[model samples]
Target: MNVLVIGGTGTTGSLLAKLLPHARVGTRKPVRDGQVRFDWDVPATFGTALDGVDRVYLIPPVGVADPAPVVESFLVRARLVRRVVLLSSSAVPESATGMGALPALVRTMPEWAVLRPSWFMQNFTGDHAVAAGVRDGEIVTATGDGRIGFVDAADIAAVAARALTDPLPHNTDHLITGPEALSYADAAAIITELTGRPVAHRSVSTEELTGRLATWLPPEFAVILAKLDEDIRGGAEDRVTSTVLDVTGRPPRSFRDFFRGFLS
Candidate 1:
């Protein structure tokens, strides 16, 4: 089955592309071999990326205030693609506005599966908010004692691959999560034990987090992140799910496993 993998250079997208070899990779700049120059902002490139593609692994643009318009326009021409697997957030409500409207939008497809994964385990390895602080021995967040079932990007991509290649699509939204829920303190301790780095988990207020993130991200995006932290602080995302094992026939990797992989 021909497939189109969006965000091909990104963490999960790169892994998904590797697993689904021969698939076209859609990126802003097609630098790597087999990568196609596809940008969500440029509709002119969609036809080339979607040509002969029966399936798609959709990765929405980050930091966009409203992704609905672009998503709507893309789907208008994505009529031939029978299957689409959308990467979304567990924190984004199906009824919420802005990017939160993504899940509901993809549901309009003929056969599609929406993956709402929580925080990724790659935060420490990649260029995420906590990565910079982890190396500096100070991981700061506003998520107090709340825990998150940090799903690994590998596992998320595995599920997406399965959704795209299976004889029948999952045809439903699933919340993907790791095996266990862990607090920031637990994460810091694990980093300290595994990397020999004296890491500390410093919890701040939502206001403080917004101010800190505003320096790097747009103010709106910063507020959205801080709001997610606020939800975590309220103990909203502190739970685990068995969807990973159910879909992949293998239990989700633990935080320790992801960390070890990062170290290697």
Candidate 2:
């Protein structure tokens, strides 16, 4: 089946593209041979991206407060596609606004799966603010004492590949997570142990974090991120799931193992 992977240059999307070598990569700029020009803001690109594609791995536009309108437009054009898999957050349930609302749309497809993954373990190693702080030997957050089951991006991509290729469609939401739940402090300690560098978790108030994050992100988006941290502080994300193992037939990699692999 022809598959279109939106956000193909992104973390999990790139990994998913690698796993499915024949998949068409939907990106803003079509640099590579298999890449197609697809932009969420540009509705004209949707038809071209969906051309002859039978399956889709959907990643919604980032930082939009409610992406349902534009995403729905895209899906309307993808009516011919049989299977659609959405990448959503574990914190956002179905029927909720923003990414949460996407699962319901994917469910409308002939075959569909919603991947509700916890926070990514790559947050400390990617281009996010946490990664910048990690490089500076400090990780700052408003999440105080709350634990998160941070899954590896590769694992999330693995599950997506399975969901896209499995003979029987998984018409359900999958809560993907790593094996253990860890606090930001625990994450810092692990980084220090692994890298021989003193990494610290500096906890702050939600307001302060919002202000800090606003320097880099849009003010509205910054507020949303800060609120998510506040929710995490209240233990909203402190749990694990067996989605990676169940879908990929292998246990998800632990954060420590991920760090080791990243270091090497």
Candidate 3:
């Protein structure tokens, strides 16, 4: 089936593109065949991306506070598409503040699956902290002793591909977590072992971290991130779930294994 992957150049989207060659990847910039230029912020480009697409792997732009309207707009345009698989976050519950709207709209689709995955292991290697830390030898966060189940982005893509290509149960929200939970301190230790350097996970207070992050992230988002860190420290995402095994029929990859493969 022909599929459209939003954010197609990103971590999970890139993996999905590699796994499903026939799928059309949507990006804001010009891309190769089976890829179309599309932007979530631009409504006029939605039709071009959705045209002839049977399914979609929906990834809302990051740091978006209200994605219901964006998702609703996409679903309206993708009327012929059979299924939609949304990449959501485990931190925001369906009933929680600033988290319920997108998934709620997706449930209205004929067939939909919401993948609420835990913190991505790639956030360290690919995106923010770890890559910078690798360059500078320091990883800083406001999460003090917070253990998180950091799932691999590849695993998230696998589940998304299944949900898009296979006959999936409708309106299902799959909470995907890693095989184990580890704190920032634990993760630092693993990185230190892998890189053979004196890397550190420095814990900062919420106010200070928020102030520091304000330079990079929007003030509102920085505040949300700080709260999320506190929530992590409270052990909200410490438990490993069986969703990955149940959906993919294999054990979720552990942090140590992921670190060895990707970080080492």
Candidate 4:
């Protein structure tokens, strides 16, 4: 069956695309074979991407606080598709507003699965601001000492691949995470140990972080992101789960192991 992987060039999506045998990559620009042009803001591209697609692995639009409308429109057009797997955040609960609302909508499909993954371990080594801060010798956040169960993007993709191709739909949400919970400071110490670069974690206030983030993101999105840090500071993300093992039949890689390659 043809499977469409939306946001297929992104961190988890790209990995997932490689894992699926019959995957069509949906991106804003189609530069390679099997890569179709798709834009969440441009509904005109949805039909062509959905053509002949039997299932889909969906990643919501980046920086969109509320994606239900656009996603709903796409689902309406893709009603004939057999299964839909959504990538969501652990912080967002089912039926809540914004991305949270998507899980409920996906449940309405013939077959659906939701992956509520924790913070990505890649954020510290990839193109994110945290990675930039690490390059600048520090990791700045408003999360204080609160820890997060940062899972690797590859682990998330593994679970997504299974959800998209399993003999039957999972028909449930999977709370995916790594084996351990660690604060930004813990990650920084690990990075310093690996790279010998003396990286540090700098804690800041939510207001300060929001202002700093606003330099890159929209003011409203900056507020939301800073508030998520506040949630992390409250111990919201300080937990681990075995969903990766249960779903993928292998344990999720730890943050340290995932970091060694990037930092060392």
Q: What does candidate 3's lDDT look like per residue over 29-126, in tens digits?
A: 95587779998789999999998988889898778776777777788888898788888889986753355677887787888899999999987787
lDDT of 4 by residue, 30-69 (tens): 9999899999999999999999998999898889889899
In candidate 1, position 114 carries an lDDT of 95
Clashes (backbone N, CA, C under 3 Å), per candidate, total 0, 0, 0, 0
Best-fitting candidate, scored by lDDT:
2
lDDT of every model, 2 decimals: 0.90, 0.94, 0.84, 0.92
Worst 10 residues of 4 by lDDT: 91-100
Candidate 3: stretches off by over 4 Å: 95-97
Score residue 98 of candidate 4 by CA lDDT.
84
Candidate 3: give its CA RMSD in angstroms.
1.7
Regions of model 1 farther than 4 Å from truth:
none
Supply candidate 3's per-residue lDDT for 218: 89
**Candidate 3 TM-score, true structure as reference:** 0.94
Ranking by lDDT: 2, 4, 1, 3
